[model samples]
Target: MKDTAKHQGLRNQLVSLLEQKGITDKNVLEAIKKIPRHLFLNSSFEDYAYQDKAFPIGAGQTISQPYTVAFQSQLLEVKKEHKILEIGTGSGYQTAVLCAMGAKVYTVERQIELFKKTSVLFRKLGIRPKYFASGDGYKGLELHAPYDSILVTAGAPIIPKPLMAQLKIGGRLVIPLGEDVQIMTLLIRKNETQFEKHEFGEFRFVPLLEDKN
Candidate 1:
């Protein structure tokens, strides 16, 4: 529960490594540095939490590698109080990162096992996302539609249509598109009917399951 001086020191080192890897967003880096990632993992994994690698949390999901988390967060260009929709809550590390950045996050998780576990963890950690749902990620939360940003943490076969339609104009949708290995894709909503697409290399992520309930 306590983030020690050693933990902060390791996080600072992680930020330095991310900078070397071309991460330029200071806010993203700061958020990463502030989040106590070890608390999101198994106690045995506490030693490896700050490394630039992903570690399995439980179920089939992994707490995303620090670099990937920072990269997606940087791509979104989050501003204070921006309404962000997170498609995969996973370990709630990414959720905490967005919350730490002052974004009002509405996060959905399909794995009921994980959703149940993480929802409790969020309160214990004092991280309050704007909303939390245990259901399909493909169907964006319509009640909270028109988001300022949408971040999909898992690999998707295609951009989920409902998510795109729910985006506010000028909002950024950052998702990875693929089966085994996903290509990070960014869609900036230009208007009601169109989105500007850009692909940024490749990343590996657990598949974003459609319906598991």
Candidate 2:
């Protein structure tokens, strides 16, 4: 649970690498810098936490690579106090980033072990998301509909209709869509029935599963 000066130095290097890879949003970068990513991984993986790579965090899921987190966060254009819904709260790394940027995050995770473990981690780190639930993300959190932005951290075979319907008008939903290798996609809700779509290359993630554990 220690975030040493050495860990901070490593994060600085990682942020520089992210900048070189075209992550231009300062807010995202700052959030990435502030969060102690090493604490989110198993102790054995702490040394590699700042390497811009994904690591398994039990339950057959992996914390997303740093670049993917930055890219998806940038696409959402998150603002202070934005009501954000995040699917797949794997290690709570993404949720912490959103919270650090001042978004009121409502995140859901299907893996029970991760959901419970990360819930504790959030409290220990003082990263207060609006809500965190153990559930099937494909359904979206309908109880809290109309989000300012939605971010899906895992690969999905299709854009889940429930998630699309939950977005506020002009809100963005950033997701990685595909089976094997996912395409990073952004969908902006134009109105009740229309969305503007864009794609930004490929990323691989653990598949977004259907039911709760």
TM-score of each: 0.98, 0.98
TM-score of 2: 0.98
Candidate 1 total steric clashes? 0
Give the local distance difference test score of model 2.
0.94
Q: Candidate 2 residues 1-213, lDDT tens each?
A: 788999999999999999999999999999999999999999999878999899999999998889999999999999999999999999999999999999999999998899999999998998899989999999999999999999999999999999999999999999999999999999999999999999999899999999844
Task: Give the runs in model 1 whose Cα sits over 4 Å from its true position.
Answer: none
Deviation (Å) of 116 in candidate 2: 0.8
Query: For candidate 1, what's the RMSD?
Result: 0.9
Residue 202 of model 2, lDDT score = 84
Q: Per-residue alpha-carbon lDDT of model 1 for 1-213, expressed as tens digits? A: 779999999999999999999999989999999999999998999999999999998898999999999999999999999999999999999999999998999999998899999988898998999999887999989998889999999999989999999999999999999999999999999998999999999999999998845
The whole-model lDDT of each prediction reads 0.95, 0.94
